[model samples]
Target: MEPEAKWNGSSDQVEFSRMSPRSQGFTKLPGQKTCGKSVLLFTFVLLISAALWGTLLFLFITRYQEIVQDLGKLRESCVYHNDSGILTVIGQLQETQLNLKTNVPQLSKTLNKLQEDQTTLKSKASQFSQQLNRFEEDGTAFRSQVLNEKNTATQAREKLQEEIQKLWIEFQRANGSICTKCPENWQVFQKKCYFFGKEPKTWAQAKYACINLQGRLVSIKSREEQVFLNRNANKKGSWIGLRDLDIEGIFLWMDGSSLNYTNWGRGEPNNQGQGEDCVAMRGTSGLWNDANCRGQQDSWICEKLATC
Candidate 1:
């Protein structure tokens, strides 16, 4: 039979009596079972979602801690590397400074020495320039003096020549001949007189002797005069009016005339012993020889214009 269902107001429940088997099966409804299954499934899904979120949160915290630690280590390493690099740079800079300190003084001293040497060179150059200037000035003055002396010598020689010509004319007019007679012991040739001395005297002595006799040492001009003097020389070495008293190796006559003719022997005027400065005629060949002026003694010849 089917159970009758009644509502009990005091219990607020539904009562089943004399229930059939079909009604007993009706206690568990299909909609209530489906609703319970749906609630259990939703609870299980919520638990699984919570567990997954906790796990993900733990992993994230752990990774964050590891990253913080790695950052700290990197900071420390960078600080240490920077400190080491700074120390190395500081050491190098210090070494460079020390080298500069060591070398600066020496470099300064070298520069100073160079400056001093340059100054000394400039001073020496200035002194040399001054000396050269003085030498040039002195040379100009010497040239002027020499020119004046040469002009004076030329004028004196011309005046003396005019006086000699006048005297010669007067003598010729007085004697009624082309030439006056010469003094005794004097040989006459071509309007001139010559005297040969026998005494052996120094060149200075012979020169003075001729001057005392109002004549001069013989100056042989032409070939004829030379031959005449040679013939009368008596084959004896005699002093002539040729000498290099002023300058060596430059013979000039006593009257300041340059040599127009020379009759020098072989290797003559060698200035033997650096002392021979006078000229003499050789007795054998009539060729000239250089002799010592003050040290040698030789016979001499004198010459003068013929007089009335």
Candidate 2:
């Protein structure tokens, strides 16, 4: 048993209590009554608390690591989605650029076509203007030609009128009415045409000239025919269609008909020692006379049927 230490007068002396503080199976110490069983129980309780704290800390650290891994996976998913969006935008831009390249050349070609069409229109307008000028020149030339033709026709009409006036004056001085519209330089009788010669010819030549006019030499069928022919002789002896070539002193007409008419002059048909075989009419007395067939210095007269 152990005595309890008194505090007041116990500097050197200790007081003892009636109850001892020591328990069973304890190592008693100075004045404390600590038992071995109590000490061992306290130590066991401290060990269990330390073990629980360490287990709680380990569980928190494991949960934090799991959260960090989930965050990393989310970041990777967002990056992939953003990259796909950017690629889609870039592809759209490239398509737009290609469309611009294709359309721009077509627009340029259309503009060029418009310019060409404008130039062609201008060229055609110039050609049309040139053609119009040519047409005007041709019209002027045609009008000039028509005016010249009109002037020529007027001059011809005036000359024809003067000729008609001269012919009317001559007809007033004749013995009978004149025929109209005879050929130029030919005298018109009742139904015959007479051509007067300016030059002299032989009796045979005179007969041939009448033949060339579609007739024979003049033959007197009546006194009126003889008088009509003598007026045209103009004071010159003219040949008649009378000859004695077949028989001397038995005269035959040049037309081979019977000698049905005669108008012998005063010293007629003596043959004149020159073989006078052709007959002629004297213009002064208008009487028939035999002449040499080859005699020159005699005017010729041609007779033909009148065409009108």
- Evaluated with TM-score, which candidate comes out highest? 1
lDDT of 2 at 102: 94
Report the C-alpha displacement of residue 243, candidate 1, in angstroms.
0.8
lDDT of 1: 0.86
- For 88-136, candidate 2 gives per-residue lDDT tens digits of 9999999999998999999899989999999999999999999999998
State the weakest 10-residue window (summed lDDT) of model 1: 1-10
**For every candidate structure, what is the RMSD over all alpha carbons to the true structure, in angstroms?**
24.3, 36.8
Give the total clashing residue pairs for model 2: 0
For model 1, the superposed segments whose C-alpha errors exceed 4 Å read 1-167, 170-176
**Residue 94 CA error for candidate 2 (Å)?**
99
How big is the positional error of residue 218 in model 2, measured in Å on the Cα after superposition?
1.0
The models' CA-based lDDT, in order, is 0.86, 0.74
lDDT of 1 at 174: 78
